[model samples]
Target: MTSADARDAGDAEAFPTVQLDLPVPTNVRVRTAEFVKSSVEISQCPKEGPPEFAVIGRSNVGKSSLINMLTGRKALAQVSKEPGKTQCINHFIINDSWYLVDMPGYGYAKRSKDQRREFDAFTKAYFKQRGTLAMVLLLVDGSIPPQPADLDYAAWLASAGVPFSIVFTKADKKKKGGPRALSNVAAFKRALLEARGFPLVPPSVVTSAATGDGKSELLAFVASLRGMWEAAKKRR
Candidate 1:
């Protein structure tokens, strides 16, 4: 296995694997998805242009697959079964109008601990500095209960004034138990509210890359905010 494979980590056994349970819509189809460039710092990012919506998660959260599934571009973002292959801020132009930013997966990466820390340093700067970032898709593994890292990241986003939505990935995988993903999702909400005292439990959707679940809901969310970031430019 590659270093990426070896480094990919996931929390095992949270609840029953969630089923294909979320309602799906058909509108807001992606007309085109094209990878533009990758950047190490916010300075390297594309000029303050189309609104950018980012996707971020733990290394093994099925983030690449979820992005591919969401855009209906089977190969849009590089898919790695291992964790930490993506080490840059990847920009994908969506419909030539907006950008779908695929951030390096957090919590795990193939890089050395110091390198991972360095990665986080720059990305955090990007989040704080990028004026065109419209939203962040906080991809989470739906099969597990609340993870401390996930909760903390969500809290950080809120504290930083970043608009984000939790997009639960892997809704199709199921293990033997009572309620599947729904239990984990609910537990996550409770933990965020109770443990983090996060007052506003942000919008969330259950999704499965395997079954293309929650694709339209996510796309609809993205569509709803495509050009809204233009206001960010004027404030800068």
Candidate 2:
């Protein structure tokens, strides 16, 4: 076990597990969701308007599963067995308030060089030009160790000055009462710290679509950011 694992084990032993039922606020609850549009290029996306939260990750990181789980709707975002199925910027309006943007996944080996370049251009433009983007939820597979693509993307986001948070998905796959996921998360954090040479790493959350874990937390976070976004808009 790594030092991070040792620390995690100690912390787990020190703390007692508690379940709290907290009421979700009105803004956070997904009363209604509808598919808005799909855009192959960033220029084709909706004009600067509502605050947008983007969901992105490497291919097959369970992004669609997490999105559907958070919204409490089945089949909201199409889940496909095939990797790199999402080829466009798919938008879904939540409660007719904010936009949930699903971006194309990166680092698919089967994609041709030209296809990868096209996607790279699309994603880069979206990230660079999307002025109304509030935050990006970068999903990572929690069952495995830190991936180079994930780490590199995190660094790129930081350098681009894009606001994002890490969402570790597939937590349910980890062994019950085991620290594999936590250890992996810790290792990722350490890697980030080493790369950035700063103790401050992007905020991260663990999630499990199968058990609906972290759904409320994720919604609550979005709600908080939405409140700030609305307030900022009003001020402007």
Q: Best-fitting candidate, measured by TM-score?
A: 2
The alpha-carbon deviation from the true structure for residue 63 of candidate 2, after best TM-score superposition, in angstroms, is 1.3
Quantify all predictions' global Cα lDDT against the true fold: 0.76, 0.80
User: What residue pairs are clashing in model 1?
Assistant: 17-174, 17-175, 18-181
Per-residue lDDT of model 2, residues 129-189, tens digit only? 8999998899988778888999988888888988888888887775333544456666667
Sequence-dependent TM-score of model 2: 0.86
Candidate 2 global CA lDDT score: 0.80
lDDT of 1 by residue, 135-180 (tens): 7889888777778999989899889988788898887776223532
lDDT of 1: 0.76
Best by lDDT: 2
> Candidate 1: where is the Cα deviation over 4 Å?
1-27, 175-182, 227-236
